[model samples]
Target: MSFPQLLTPEEKLAQGKTALGIRDVVVLCGSMRFAADMAEVAIQESVAGALVLKPDCNMKIAHPLWADPVEAEALKVRLDDQHKQKIRLADRVIVVGDYIGDSTRGEIAYARELGKPIRFTDPEVDPGEPGGDPAAEETAR
Candidate 1:
């Protein structure tokens, strides 16, 4: 089953380097702590697949947590600046977070503030939509 279009992720990012002249994409996820790595991988893979499908663009994975930090304060500042830089530099930002509370809300808000589209993943729910019908006998048409 498919989700309501509006509820589905925003449309794909289109930036054909040869034609559209846009070259790079930077993806930022809410947290790459543990299992979240899979979601981040999926996010990168999708954009990479798009580039491969068209062969007109290049996508770069921007995992901010990998940034080096000399100290706690420096880490904070670096993260803050890197976040904004990704928004400014990339053609778009993809944020992958679970269906729980707004785990990616801050990223989404940041992207929105920069007028960028935000994408999400529902790990618990099926890919396209929710689970099987709970009321299976209501109207078995």
Candidate 2:
């Protein structure tokens, strides 16, 4: 008379295992050139782009540089510790490119060393253009 017997075999199996919940992703951007003043917009675009293609994903972001660094050691400590923590916690990372060199390179390398899924996506773009406008882009997140 209980619900357990009423449930199909598949439902019973599913009930025994933990639900595979929605995944969380964090993006590591290559360019901080525009991120300084427009951090919110820039980050939003990056995160949205990733989630747009991959719905049901949670997104976080990381800065390539530590702004509040008090000294050289402080800078390394903040960057190495905080940045790595976020990346390690992320389920996946999307590396954006205006034209990649160091920023993309470093982010990709770090994510790779951690054995996370890594992919590259286009920077936001205007309606018809190939890529996004450099000046007006906003960090929406």
Candidate 3:
């Protein structure tokens, strides 16, 4: 018979928080172009007593670490998957930007699919909100 696998570090952390009754876990999702703005929101979330998780790097900026084309593409894929994992670990998701690109839009859809509560820094861009444009949701779907 197959038994359960060990919890990952992220899972362990989440379990620990739940055991400790620390429920405010927020994940930030948006384009890397608004990385700075997301950082500010992270600070605000932290101050508001949330355990905030966000993009650790802005890969759009030129960097020696991701200088190679193949490496950079692979890293981008890895980072996107990691962010999805963060979303899974989070209790809530926050989209932090005025513009909603394909990636961010996909994140929003995924959050919605998972039944996680989502808030937008720019409410106008929230596709689920009134007057949020059906076109965007169509494109996202």
Candidate 4:
């Protein structure tokens, strides 16, 4: 008697999504300054029949909850971790802005490590592509 082969993490995620009747899982990554751009991309992804995941909060927004420097820093760390989880779960990543900040760059790297396909709203800013500048920030805008 032989045991079945164990599934890879990507395979496991695909199986789970299939069990849930999800066709495609797309995660959006970008600077919080382009939250509006991300929102637009989310809508487009949804309309295209993808299950979209994105940052749910814009910490840059003036909020009493995160007004304290220490508290805001802690929240930022937690949020970044959560976004990485989203990238792990997603089958693909869509970067939703012309700008790629440090946080977004990290997310893109994580997604690449997971072998997830990545697309950019502004293709010129895609670090994985030819002539794409990883250090570029807000230059395309």
Highest-scoring model, TM-score: 4
Q: Model 3, stretches more than 4 Å misplaced?
A: 1-16, 129-141
lDDT of each: 0.43, 0.47, 0.83, 0.82
Q: Rank the candidates by TM-score, best first.
A: 4, 3, 1, 2
**Candidate 4 worst ten-residue window by lDDT:** 132-141
Clash-forming residue pairs, model 4:
none
> Which scores higher on TM-score, 1 or 4?
4
What TM-score number comes out for model 1? 0.45
Over the full model, what C-alpha lDDT does candidate 2 score relative to the true structure?
Answer: 0.47
Taking all chains together, the TM-score of candidate 2 against the true structure is 0.43
Q: Judged by lDDT relative to the true structure, which candidate is superior, 1 or 3? A: 3
Question: What is residue 100's positional error in candidate 1, in angstroms?
Answer: 7.4
In Å, residue 132's CA in model 2 sits off its true spot by: 29
The sequence of per-residue lDDT tens digits that candidate 4 reaches over residues 34-58 is: 9888898898879988889999988
lDDT of 1: 0.43
For candidate 3, the lDDT comes to 0.83
* lDDT digits (tens) for residues 1-141 of candidate 3: 999999987679778988999888899999999998999999998998899999897898999989999999999999989999989888888888899998888888887776577877887887673445433332210
The residue ranges of model 4 lying beyond 4 angstroms of the native Cα positions read 129-141
